[model samples]
Target: MASLRRVFATSILASVLSQVLTATAQPAFGVCYGMLGDNLPTPAAAIQLYKNHNIGTMQLYDPNPEALQALGNSGISVILGTKNEDLPNLASSVEAAKSWIDAHVLPYQGVNIKYIAVGDEVIPGESAQCVLPAMQNLQSAISGSSFSSVAMTTAVSGTVLGASYPPSSGAFTGDAKRALSGILQFLSNTHAPLLINVYPYFAYAADPSNIRLDYALFTAPGPVVRDGDLSYWNLLDAMVDAYYAAMERENFPNVGVVISESGWPSAGNGNFTTPQLALTYNRNFMKKIVAGTGTPKRPDSHLDGNIFAMFNEDLKSAGEEQNFGLFYPDGTPVYPIFS
Candidate 1:
């Protein structure tokens, strides 16, 4: 009797330990590592920067070999991307997809690669045709390989949706609908989340007269918008819920949504792009993610978000594009983001 009791207690302790380890393994938030700049730090130094800030995941704009080498054995999750131009080639030939994966993915044996994003915002017009085929081929390639556990999907722009204001009224229209529907089907089949780049800054910058700065920064004085029974305190939550509503409208309510890119520019041509505003937005955004409170529409679900950039890209032509990074090229943070 005593031996059986001891065995039962050991089983309970093992179960509890497993739960704790699983929770610890999951990252609360991550940052985007855009290597579009001329003076960004080397991969090794950049990895240390992420470690210093406690960023447990990284979304790279491409499967950079140097970056992969630095990330190996670091335990940071990676979401590597394939350039849009490569999509057509990859879509046309499964062998090409396998070759690309073998060259880029198989070589990084020790890196914690979590997902492979096919292309960025390619679900529109001519490029839309390549999205699913590339994803399918890539999925097949991964399934046959040792890296089958890595999720596959593409990143889309929030501009793909129509009538996103009321959240509940959101829908994909015209070409976007056809393109997104097929992509949604692929995601459903593979059990991969739909990654969307949601930037409230763009909306607010386009129409400052109607959009409150505090609301856009997630520091609203009160709930600024109401959709059906849901009250949204900030623009981020509304934007996220808008995607959820759009997915539900397409009969894909179970498909998960992950924010592939989101960040406030520290400097731009307008008053809304001040460093203080950027700091406030990113800090609050991180807090919201860490708190594990999902958007009003998907309150029970945890939303994974990646901040737009690690370093400001000096080479970007657009003023705002060069200003999105949380850090400067020399490894100095543009502002205090983490506690």
Candidate 2:
């Protein structure tokens, strides 16, 4: 254990030292700014934190007024989301979608809204029926205007996959297959990427006996899984490739993918959640992204993604959900992810 800690310390030190030479470089990835904690820093302060770290992109779970205000003219690329509960209303009436855009988006002219996610992880559930229509209405609302450049899409969890093993065999399940067909078509038509939340930590925790820790943490020294000519050294790439394969099987072969959320918990279950593991996973993940190392399936593609959250949300459900933050609510980093 001491040797392992020393290895982690050495690897982190090397990464931090390397970052000093590239302090001004724009980060290739983004972090989700979730506001579910009472002790969280103000939106302005949070925006400053992102600037201080040279972060160039962010994902907001919803259009919080203060956050959007803070983002105005800040020059940070944003992926703004709509509340799942609002989907029914937005889907039912194009006027409701137009009103939503008029209220939450148009006023913030300085904000760089890259993508507007209609709903989050509501697929394969009660609100699943509302997703495609809401996206259509929102797209119509934003058409032929400055906001037209802002892509329309929705975020879905990895559970939408029926099979993921071998990466190439990935396919959507029965329910998700039926529901996502039209949505996928819409995404392809609009040239928007499908946003997915991929968590190797959860995959490993659920079946540590089968999933290796090194594989999940991006520390595996050699290829652990070989799929035809492709080799997967880490779980992230494999998971991403699986999603791509699934999309291809769904007949949306050209639709791109953007990782909506991914992170490890700093504290929760005994061994599976720890500061060391969280730091390792996030730092390595960022490095992989910064290097523009696309997954084997999309070797030349420039992948876009966001870390799960900026700060720990104390108000979240107890355990892993609350612990997926890169920083504490007090504005201090839970681990030195930014160096």
Candidate 3:
């Protein structure tokens, strides 16, 4: 036992020194914490969940100081966002934006709030047009605040891209390009990753047979697809590399990519393993990303993902899939996912 312990310790140390060795061995995620359900656990309880589980990150749908207060003093980083409806408001009223920051974020200094996600999943609707100006205004708002190293980014729904198969032929829709160029330029300049709300479940639901279940679930797959010199074994990389390719088409290939929201619903009765599949997808995907990786094409880059939600919100639009919880409303994990 002592010899085994020594070997494991040495392996961890060597991995930190050699990037390639660590690329496949890193454990855990940086957390994707969301609270939108009526069956919801309180924010305070949720913060305790992070502490008990040794989590290090939280992705929020909006700037809720109650949640920040819940996480007070925890080193876990936060990524807060502006709602889609607030885009026009943010674009039109810089004062309102400032007021929001002062009220929502200013009171919570000496806390672990990390990133400000401005206008989440705003790239697909009529609000897409407002995204650019909203981003500019939010940047100004963040700059005006005392929060340092706190990044400002936007979330784009996967629908922004027109083609995503083969991973390399990815490109944004013609209309989406003109509408989003300004925001893209801003992100490129500011050095923020393109935060995307990716749902491979949608891809599988669109066609399950063509998409292998194991690949989506991150289980050991049949074989890697050798599309010429490029290779892929899972749906997550295919979905992400498409973004890389699309961004490359737009001449901003180096901009970072982050999975701002990605998870399986714990119990979607009518759909594919809504919650179970969600757990599987997140478990395998998070393990891989935290290990420091990208698609075979972008292997040097480490992938960063935030799981979709924290609670199985019964109040979230009355949809079954809205219950995308790693934990039940009472703070018990729905599944014993950890080894």
Clashing pairs in 3: 37-313, 264-278, 265-274, 265-275, 266-275, 267-275
Q: How many backbone clashes does candidate 1 have?
A: 0
lDDT of 3 at 58: 80
Among all windows of 10 consecutive residues in model 2, the one with the lowest summed lDDT is 12-21
Instruction: Give the per-residue lDDT of model 3 (tens digit) for 144-257.
Output: 457856777788887789998878888999877877788788888989888887887777777887887777776644545555688778788888888888998989977988
Candidate 2 per-residue lDDT, tens place, 1-339, comes to: 445445555665447635742864677788999999989999999999988877778999899999999999887999999999999999998899999999999999999999998889987889999999999999888887678899999999987999999899998888888789999999999889999999999999999999999999998999999999999999999999998999999778899899889899988888899888898898877777777778999989888778888999999999888999888887777766655
lDDT per residue for candidate 1 within 1-339, as digits (tens), equals 345334433544335433433455455778999888889899889999987766888998887899998888888889999988898999998898999899899998899888899989877768888988898898888785779999889898976888798998888877888888888988888789989898889989999999998899987878999887899999999998888889999999989988889899988767879866787777667667666779988899988888988999988878888999988999976765542
TM-score of each: 0.91, 0.95, 0.87
lDDT to native, each model: 0.84, 0.88, 0.72
Question: Every model's Cα RMSD, please?
Answer: 10.5, 2.6, 6.1
Model 2 residue 192 CA deviation in Å: 0.6
Ranking by lDDT: 2, 1, 3
Error of 1 at 80 (Å): 0.8
- Give RMSD (Å) of candidate 3 vs. truth: 6.1
Candidate 1: 10-residue stretch with minimal lDDT: 12-21
- Candidate with the larger TM-score of 1 and 2: 2
* Candidate maximizing lDDT: 2
